[model samples]
Target: MDDRIDVASLGWPAGLVGELDHRRLKAPSVKLRSARAGEHGDVTYCVDLRIRHPNADEYLTSTELHSVEHFLLEGFQRLLPEHFVSVGLMGCQTGFYLGFVNEGRSEVLCACLVRILEEMQAATVVPYANIEQCGNWRNHSLDDAQRVAREILARREHWLDAA
Candidate 1:
């Protein structure tokens, strides 16, 4: 029985395909999850955004994660209005699952993520971090979000390396 998963057939971007191939030949590591093509010809991707540093915090704090989620939702929509679908936080709090309508280019998505992080770093307040817009509005932290965004941006080269 072959346990290997054929990622190429799933319409993943080249980088993710190569990463999966490498993982198959070696030990398992973080990498993009999957991409599914909708009946309407749209592609939705489940991409991972894990932090791999050994000494650093393994997962984002709740406040940081929430703030980052808000920032990403706003940024992705503003930057990729036509393609952006939604951003959902991972249960483990290490990263997020970013959904897109038709966009499949990993590089473009990575670039957009970088831009979003940059915006987060410079943001003075968290959008929708209010009682009217958020259920736990008072639980957000812009400072922690900015710090985590800065850390992630500093390791931008490895953004594609998923878990």
Candidate 2:
């Protein structure tokens, strides 16, 4: 068996990444959360999502971890789901993650993000906050999450460079 990580074969998990990619189907239903003027010329909004497994136990509670995910998701959804490019959980951090490669200007993404933040503040239900934080963020450390984000970001950078 090949020990090497097959970067070429990797696709963002369909449930999360792939599901969001079908923007056309979702766009109409996606509500605009907020708006702002532009600050940066090229940046997209980001969202975090957390889905707890049915097998959660006492040791697996990480409000901070789940909080970040809730922060991202509600924030982005309320702000700008259209500018979304990529969505995924960090390979390491419980749910520490980012949304990268936005389609338009940073200013646009920021405006949307502001709306998202507001929505987050108003949200009543947060998915993963109650779950036990036993899993090591997909079983890795913070360093691992950073590395994963960097690698994924770089890959998108390469794709943009190619285009």
Candidate 3:
């Protein structure tokens, strides 16, 4: 069976496609997963932070995950207002999937992640966690989100190491 993915065929840049192919051969790790052109000619990228490796027995608590979601959504919008699309929690509770529209460069995305993490670390409260903005306002923890943000920021240098 042919396992190779023709990322360029999917409208990804050749340089990024090469990098993605390299990462695919390595063990699972925290990094950007893939990039492809949207039907509307926009590009969408998936970021895998892997806060908890699949092999690990631990997972993020619901409250922490919820808070992190809130922080990321607000931070991304503030920092990458033109490109940010959405943010979603990984079902495994290990990390998140960040969606950005029309941005395909891994380096740029990685840098944005760093900025978001820095903002998250300094955040005093979870944005949009109030009754008017959140569906589950009661489920959130700024402390937990900050802690995770700190941990991830400390390892920022290795975010692109997967490639």
Best by lDDT: 3
Where does the lowest 10-residue lDDT sum fall in candidate 2?
25-34
C-alpha RMSD between model 1 and the true structure: 5.4
* Clash totals for all candidate models: 4, 13, 0
**Candidate 2: tens digits of C-alpha lDDT, residues 3-31:** 23221233222233222322222210111
How would you encode candidate 1's per-residue C-alpha lDDT over 1-163 as one tens digit per residue? 0114344443333454422432222111224566666666666666656643322446577888899899989998999999988888777666676777667566677788888888887789999999999999999888988887887787676454442
Q: RMSD in angstroms, candidate 2?
A: 15.6
Whose lDDT is higher: candidate 2's or candidate 3's?
Answer: 3
By lDDT, rank the candidates, best first.
3, 1, 2
TM-score for each of the candidates: 0.77, 0.33, 0.77
lDDT of 1 at 77: 92
Candidate 3 — what's its lDDT?
A: 0.69
Candidate 3 per-residue lDDT, tens place, 96-156, comes to: 8788766646667667777887887667778998999999999988888889888777766
Q: 1 or 2, which is superior by TM-score?
A: 1
Worst 10 residues of 1 by lDDT: 21-30
Q: How close to the true structure is residue 120 of candidate 2, measured as C-alpha lDDT? A: 45
